[model samples]
Target: MTTVPRRFEILLVAGFTESDETPPTSAHALRSAVVEATGETGESGYPRYAGNGMEADIDPATRTVEALLVDGAEIDYGLSVRVVAAPAT
Candidate 1:
């Protein structure tokens, strides 16, 4: 049997709590997750600092991602995310 290639779209976020306060919408947050998932983090530097943190841990099977969000203080908040594949064009 021939193999069929599947295309998937994924999104990850720190969490809905912090995101709701941000100017962007949930959809935007989701898209950001996809961007983060695809980005690469090199050695600690200007380039790596500029990238999103959520992309660091993206799960292909569950299509999930995890990240930490920092509030005004040094304390970090965690976000567990799940991504649903987008429909084919």
Candidate 2:
């Protein structure tokens, strides 16, 4: 089994809330939300944020976001994120 992390593109969906309908506008915000929802941390004990989009490291064997067992929902912003696709190996 490989221990290296693979790159995967993530999808972020805006969920409906009683008071909020605005979706996340920046990658930073999405990254923060993902970290809050998944509670995932890197070797330095901090959430890793990729470039400008919603991209993250996913275990290729599992092909799932770590700590995000459910449909990846963040209650604060009512944002839902998921692993959409991985780059061609």
Candidate 3:
């Protein structure tokens, strides 16, 4: 089976809040859950969203992080982002 890269276009990100008391098992799980929670749909046969490398710092204080960068289109869809967080600089 071909391995899907850790990077893909994030089509949508829905705002949500989960009980932080319930800890995530692994970093992979956390990332996957977050991506799924975003409500992203990588649908084919439609205008597919593309990923842009723009990113923001995670702030535990703010409890909110900037959404991923997606190719801006006039259509009604939201932004897309990389599936995995970019490597630390």
Candidate 4:
């Protein structure tokens, strides 16, 4: 039997911390980190950073920040990469 290539949708989740002296991480910085680690680039030889409609769920109890991958292509502990099967048309 012939092998069929499978399509996948990759999602990345990361967590960070900031203090009174330090500012929050920027999208560009996150994208750059991902590119540096994975070597995934776009047409401009760099990954796209999308912050539109980006939502973050912060839990005070756990002190965690969770966000869903929404727009654009292309994060930190070095990136939690999740690859899932693409939906069929």
Count of backbone clashes, every candidate in sequence: 1, 0, 2, 0
TM-score of each model, in listed order: 0.30, 0.35, 0.22, 0.27
Model 3 scores a C-alpha lDDT of 0.29
Give model 1 RMSD, 1 decimal.
9.3
Model 1 segments more than 4 A misplaced: 1-5, 16-30, 33-61, 64-77
Superposition TM-score, candidate 4 onto the true structure? 0.27
Clash pairs (backbone) in predicted model 1: 14-79
- Could you tell me the lDDT of residue 69 within candidate 1? 29
Worst 10 residues of 3 by lDDT: 30-39
**Collision count of model 1:** 1
lDDT of 4 by residue, 17-70 (tens): 344353333331332111111222334432322233232232223323343343
Which pairs, if any, clash in model 4? Answer: none
- Worst-scoring 10-residue span by lDDT in model 2: 28-37
lDDT, model 3, position 24: 29
Model 1: how far residue 17 lies from native, Å: 10
Q: What lDDT does model 4 reach?
A: 0.32
